[model samples]
Target: MPELVGTDEDDYLTLNYNGFVPLLTKAMQEQQTEIENQQKEIDELKAQLEMIMKMMQSDMSDKTDNKKAENNQKPVKLSMATVK
Candidate 1:
């Protein structure tokens, strides 16, 4: 197995320093990229949820309006065959 060297400032000038800096930098950049990707995914999910909520609200409003219209209409007696 490879050993961890030049991990501290005390070993900063070791031959491994050149290798360690680039590797650490790459890791940081990868982590940053992952964070950005996750943020975008979260934003998309939030937008989708908002759209669903709006659709549900619109459906509820439509149902309420239909009920109001029915209430305003005069009732009529219907035969059992017409009920379906």
Candidate 2:
């Protein structure tokens, strides 16, 4: 449906809608590649976050165990009052 509508010498080299298919295809392919690369980076970051969470959990458990041991070593004192 694209018709050539040029008359001047400067309008001899004109691109129609069909001529733009290759350019659009190339642009879409490049964008897809960029999207795939970004997804790989996101996956790597998620793995790193998982490792950090595991390390924090292990450290927290150690601290909790040490606190329990300290509390067990202390003696408890009780107070009593006499009533008539």
Candidate 3:
């Protein structure tokens, strides 16, 4: 149960090196683990974003193809004399 005390000069002052070294080392290790976990989460999010973008592009392409098909169809007209 060692407590870290901050000095007025924005520095740390510790009297017990034997206890402080282990505590500091543990804190550093914990911080490293947290950074690694956050990086993994960021990578996963980037992958998900890429997948979503691909799906959106595919959907847009399908819609464009459907519109082209509709536009390529010819219109039919009936004459009044033919009907008679």
Candidate 4:
């Protein structure tokens, strides 16, 4: 609430432009400060998320390489003898 500088009820009710302007200006400044802080926080979170995604992709690639290596190994075979 803004302070009423005017002494009379009629002066206060008529709207004091001088007092109202400063109050509105202060409010706008406060809101801008809050918005800037929130934006900085959001940027930090996005950076962290990107790093996590890259790490996950690398892990998945490693798993796929291991599976391919296992599949490429040669299998062992046994010899059979004929009975008379």
The TM-scores of all predictions, comma-separated, are 0.66, 0.70, 0.68, 0.72
Per-residue lDDT for 1-84 in model 4, tens only? 445444465554544677788879999999999999999999999999999999999999999999888888857465565433
lDDT of 3 by residue, 1-84 (tens): 535543456576645556688878999999999999999999999999999999999999999999988888857678997996
Q: Which stretches of candidate 2 lie over 4 Å from their true place?
A: 1-15, 77-84
> Once superposed on the true structure, which residue ranges of model 3 sit more than 4 Å away at CA?
2-14, 74-84
TM-score of 1: 0.66
Ten consecutive residues with minimal summed lDDT in candidate 2? 1-10
Alpha-carbon deviation at 41 in model 3, angstroms: 0.8
Clashes of 2: 0
Considering summed lDDT, which 10 consecutive residues are worst modelled in model 4?
Answer: 1-10
Model 1, span 10-57: residue lDDT tens: 655335556677788989999999999999999999999999999999
TM-score of 2: 0.70
Instruction: Rank candidates, TM-score, best first.
Output: 4, 2, 3, 1
Give the top-scoring candidate (TM-score): 4
User: What Cα-based lDDT does every candidate model obtain?
Assistant: 0.84, 0.84, 0.85, 0.83
C-alpha lDDT of candidate 1 relative to the true structure: 0.84
Candidate with better lDDT, 3 vs 4? 3
